[model samples]
Target chain A: MTGRTIRIGAGAGYSGDRIEPAVELAEQGKLDYLVFECLAERTIALAQARRRADPEQGFDLLLDERMRAVLPACRANGVRIVTNMGAANPASAARAIVRIARELGMAGLKVAAVIGDDVLDQIREQPRSLSEHDGTTADLGDSVVSANAYLGMAPIVEALAGGADVVVTGRVGDPALFLGPLAYEFGWSADDWDILGRGTVIGHLLECAGQLTGGYFADPGVKDVPDLARLGFPLAEVSPDGSALLTKVPGSGGRLSVACCKEQLLYEILDPGAYLQADVVADFRTVRFEMAGPDRVRVTGGSGRARPDMLKVSIGYQDGFIGEGQISYAGLGAVARGRLALDIVRDRLAITGIDAEDLQYELIGLDAVDRTGRTGIEPREVRARAVGRSRSAYAAGRIGAEVEALYTNGPSGGGGAVASVRQVLAVTSVLLPRDRVAPAVLYEVA
Target chain B: MLLRDLAHVRTGDKGDISQISVILYDIENYALLADRLSVEVIRRHLCALPIFSGERYELPELGALNFVLRGALSGGVTRSLALDAHGKTLGAQLLDIEIISIS
Candidate 1:
C-alpha cells in the first residue's frame, strides 16, 4: 500500500466564474490537478448556436482569458488541467489551448480534447422519449438546436494516461470531471464501485469550488463568512483509500467547515442514496464529515453501485422569445405606485392585443424574490417589472413596449424605465443507450 | 422562534424542480425538525407556489431535511420569467417557517 495522497483543487464552478481564485490555486495551492466545471444545463446548447454561426467559436467565451491567466502558474507548479469549457466544441477548445500555450512560451504542452459527446444526429435518428417532459424528441421537431450526451470519465482517464497536461471535454457528467483524475492516479478499476462512489462524494463537494468554502453561506449575524470578495476555492487531499480532507488555501477568504460541506452535499440533488451519475449510482446517504482543523473537514463513508445502462442527453431547442421591462418608484406610497404601474402594464398588454403565451407582473421589492404573494410592507422604494413570452419576437417586444409606455401614460414618480427582448434557447433531457455515445480523444502538442 | 434560528437552508434547482436542504445547526434539533417538518407542513407553508407535488428525505446523522418540489420554479431558470429565475431565495423563504411552541 502507498502512503501517497493527491491534492486536487477546484478552480471555477461555472463558465463565467471568477478567474483570480483559479490562478491562486494554480500558483499557491501546490496541487497536482486543477479542474474547472464551466458548463451549466443550457450552456452547451447556447454554445451550439454560436458554433452554427461560426464553427471555430463554440467553446467557452472566457477560455482564452482563463487559460492566459492560469497557464503560467500551472506549468510552473506541474499542475494538470481538466475542464468542460469545451462546451459545444472540444477540438476547437483544445486547439485554442495549444495556441495560448505557444503564445505564453510554454511549448510542448500536451492538450487532449475528448470529442463524440455531440449526439445530435443520433438523437435526431432515434427520437427517444424525453426524460423529464411528457413528449419525445419528435414533438420538439425542427426547433431542436442541439443534443449532447453526458460522457463518463473513461476518455478523461485515457487522456491523462497519454501524458496530456490538459484534458478538455464537452458534455461529460460534472462529477466525472473530478473523478477522472482520481481513477487515473489511484488506478481504480471500472468495477470498483465503493472507491468510485467515495471519490464521487469528493467530486461533488469540490465541483462548485467556492460553495464549499462559504460562497453562499453568509448571513448578517448567522453563518457569517468573512471576506467574500476574495473567497478561496476548495481543494481535497485524497488518499488511495477514498477518504478526503476538504480545505481551502491558508489566509484566504471564506470558511471551510462541516456546515458548508453539508449544504453542498445536497445541492441540486434529489435522492441522497441514489445520485445517478454516468459512472456509478453514488450513495451519499452514509457520508459523514468532521472538523479536522480550523479550515479543514474530514469526509468519509460513501459507497456506490454499478454504472447505468443509459446515458442522459441535454437537448436544446428554440423556445420562443421572452421580453421584459422594469420601472422604479420611490418615496411615500412607493409600493402603491409600483402596484399601479404593474396593473397598468397588465391592462395595457391586454389592450394592445398582445399574443403572449405567458405573462407575469411583479413588484420587485415587495414580492419578486419569494413569489409567495405580496409581503404587504410599504417600503421606501419599489420596481415594477412586467415579463412575457411569445412565439414571435414582435409579440414579445409588445409586452415590454407597454411597460415602457407607462412612463408617459400612467403612474406618478416613475423612473429608470428599461426594456429588452431576447431569444430563449431552452433545454430539456432525454436518455440514450450507452453504446450510442462513443467518446474519442484527440491530442494537441504546444 | 422561527426555523432560521435553529437551521440554515440551501436551495438548488434542476429544470422545474427545486431542491431545498434544511440543515440544523445542532444535531439535537434533528428530532424536532424531522417530527414537525413534514411534506404536508412544507406544502402548506409554500402553498402560494404552483407546486404539483413534494417529497421529503431525512438525513438524521447529518441533521438535515431535503425537500424536492416539482413544478416550483415555473419552468426552471432557463424558462422562468421570475426575477430570481433559479429560485435561489427559496431557501431564505423556507427559513421563515415558524417553529411554533418549541419548549
Candidate 2:
C-alpha cells in the first residue's frame, strides 16, 4: 500500500477564496484527497462570536456553497475531502457536509469531525503561559473570547484510517490538513521525523493553493504569467519516500515553474533551517526545485528534527473598536484638499475629546502606501482617510463621524464621504504542553 | 537602478509581523543584492512606521534574501484600521529602493 503514490490537491487556501479552482481540481486533478486549508490566525475567534450568536452556526460561511460546488465532482472522481473550514465547530460543519452529500445522492458518505482543539476550558483551568507576548491568560481577563490549540496530524490520520470520506477539522495546523492524509497513506510513523519533515515541506508549499501555481506570482511586464485570471490550484504526487512532484491540472491557466516554487518555499516563514510545525520542525535549508516538465517542479532535500514539546495556541480577545472615515477629492489640487480634509478631522477629533490609539491620517493615493512622501508627481485625485482605535464603540464611531462632517463643514469638492466602525477582535499567542490538548475524532455518516 | 530591475519581492504576514522575501531574477546578482540590501537599508527605506525590529536571512542557494519585520502591521490584520491590513503592499513599496551597481 505504501509503494503506490498518492496525489493530493489544494482546494482553497483561506476562507473566502475563490470556488471555481477547487471545482476544477475535483473534476480534473486525479487525486486521492482534496484539502482546503481555510482558517487564518483570527478566523476561529471571530467564528466563536458567530457560535455565541447561534450554537449551530460557527463554521465557515462558504462551507455550504463550497460543498455544493465540489462534492458532486469529488464523489464522481473518488477524491476524498479534508478541510479546516469547520472553524469553531467541526461537528456542525460535518453535519452540514453530510446533508449536502446525501442531497447529491451520495448516501452513506463518511465524514469525520476532528474536535478537542478548542481548549478554552483547558486554559481557563490552568491559564497557559503566553508565547508571543509578555502576559498570562489572567492578564487577558474577561475580554477573552476564545482559545484554540493548534492540533497535529495524529487525529486526522486516525480519522482517515477509520475510512472517513470527508474530514472536517477545527483549528488544526494548516499543514496538518495535508500532512495527515500523507501520513495515513504512507503509514509513516509519528516518530519518523525526517519523512514527516519532508511531508511538511509539501504541505507548506500547497497549503496556499493557487500561490504555488502563479496566481500570486504574476508581475505583468516584469514576470509574465498566462491566463492568470483563471489561475489553477496546486497538487502534489508523493511517493513513499516522502519525495513529491508538485504540479497543477493539465490545461489549467497558470504558470508553475521553479521561480513560483522558490517564492512559496520561503513564504511566511522566518527561519528556513527550522520551520516549525506541529508534526515536525522541517528544515528547508537544502531544499531544491528542479524543472521536470511543463507545470511540474521536482522538490527534494527536505529534512526534519524532533517536534516541539509545547503546542502554540491562538487566544482571541476583544481589544477595542476601530473607526474609519474616507472622503475623495478630484481635479487639480486634489492632494491639497485631501490633506486639508485630514487636518480638519484631526483637529475635530481632539476638540471632540475622543480618546483613541494608533490614530493615522493619510492621503490615499499620495502617501498612504509610500510613507517616505517621496512621490514628487501629484495625482489629479486623492482620498482623505482618518482611522483610529478607541476603547469604546461609541468613541470609535466619532472618528468616522468627524470625517463625514467634513462633507459640509470642511473642504469643498470632498465627495464620496463614507464612515464606519467595528469592534476589534485582537489575537495573541500562548503555548501549552502537548499533553494538555486532547484531540478527539467523531464520525457523521450520511 | 531600482532594486525591481534585478529582484522581485513577496510579502507574508503572521500576526503583527511581516515577512518579505526578495528573490533575484538571476542567480549571479545574489552577491550584489546581499551586499546592498542590509537590515539598516530596509529600516531606513521603511522609516515611516518605526519597525520595532528586523532580521535578515540569506539563502544563497535560492538567490533570495528574506527580511522579517516586527511590529509592522499596526497591530495585525485582526485589529488594524489600515485599508491594507495584511501589509501586502509593502513588497511593492520596497521595490523602490535604488541599487547602486558596483560593476
Interface RMSD per candidate (angstroms):
1.1, 1.3
Superposed model 2: Cα runs more than 4 Å off: none
Per-residue CA lDDT of model 1 for A222-242, tens digit only, reads 889989999999999999989
- Displacement of residue A423 (Cα, Å) in model 1 is 0.5
Which residue pairs collide in model 2, if any? none
For candidate 1, the TM-score of chain A alone versus the native chain A is: 0.98
Model 2 lDDT tens row, A312-379: 99999998899999999999889988999999999988888999888999988877776454777789
Off by over 4 Å in 1: A374-376, B101-103
- What's the number of clashes in each of the models? 1, 0
Find the candidate with the highest DockQ and give its number. Answer: 1
For candidate 2, the docking band is: medium
Worst 10 residues of 2 chain B by lDDT: B42-51
Clashes of 1: 1
Error of 1 at A374 (Å): 5.6
Best-fitting candidate, scored by lDDT: 1
Model 2, residue A191: distance off in Å is: 1.4
